[model samples]
Target: MSSSQLPVRAAGNLRSDAGRNRAEIVSAARAVFTEAGTDVPTSRIARRAGVAVATLYRRFPTREALVEAAFADQHADCSRFFSVVEQHPEPWPALRTALRRFCAEQARDKGFTAHLLAACLQGRAPAGAAATSALEAERLTALVRRARDSGAMRPDVGLTELHLLVAGNAGVVAASPPDQAAAASRRFVELFLRSLEVPRRSGAGDGVR
Candidate 1:
């Protein structure tokens, strides 16, 4: 090949190699975070991806950036789930499905769950994630109002309580043995949902919130 053509070919190869290395690093980071946690060292991820630590760093400048990329699918799924729930015609069913699906995901994906919880608590999520969270929160508020208006939920129930329910259940799922977490999460959500129902009273307490 001519000298000029050689440099162009070399650049093309470099781009291809960089793309492959970035994908490997992201895949490795996801697996490592799943088996261990985000706290695992970057060197471990590099070793798993069969790339140098410098390569990993070149692709993802910060640990959080790697985490954001690794969990990007989970984040997109959650965003889509919330959008679906927002469109459901029935508020109660939407609430129930949202809780069940969210908890199930939390149990199945501990790494994603960890990042989600941290993002919510620390206000440090990526821009896209933060927008999703805000959108979900707004939809949740509307859902809660609809549920209360329909008498499916108690008058005293509010949006903050729903947040607490998800956050608390996420912790339960995170703390349980991986094998049993899904079942446990389902049971917990069922109990919480039942508790939110407006009760039929027999006396003067009938209207109590």
Candidate 2:
């Protein structure tokens, strides 16, 4: 999902209309940002959204505000994504499926992708926490719950640690080639998950580092 910022004229209007227009702008901005990257001018965002530049400014007075709003929408989208995962038969495979989709998105989209890098600079590029940024930390929380229940992921693993892992992997996959990066990223997840597993019974020899 993408969001666009409103221009000046779009702002200072009726409250409900202003709110609706702002929401529309955000949706447009999300698409534009994803297609054009954050470098794309906010004017372009307004044009893409079919709103006047003044309207864009009226709604979002600053680039940072627009950026934050777009990121938040992406986060909301992520929360909705959990609905898809809930359909899965179990959690481990479900987590893998989610990660695979994430890898694909990171590899393809520019706006949302750049957001990942921005996270490193404390730019707060959206990473599945915008909407739920308040109380729900579903992605990492789900992964940790599944891991702990599996007796595979270290019981010590928690939401923060898992979120970091997800963020790190997204950054890595985003920089990778668009075609095969999803497969490669999924491999990374698989290996990580495998490493968390309890050791097999000593079939033959003691484990080696």
Q: Name the Cα RMSD for model 1.
A: 4.2
Please give, for residues 93-120, the per-residue lDDT of candidate 2 as tens digits.
6765665565557656767655644442
lDDT of each: 0.77, 0.66
What's model 1's overall lDDT?
0.77
Name the candidate that leads on TM-score: 1
Q: State the displacement of the C-alpha of residue 6, model 2, in Å, after optimal TM-score superposition.
A: 29
TM-score of model 1 relative to the true fold? 0.77
Best model per lDDT: 1
Q: Output the lDDT of residue 185, model 2.
A: 69
Cα lDDT of candidate 2 equals 0.66
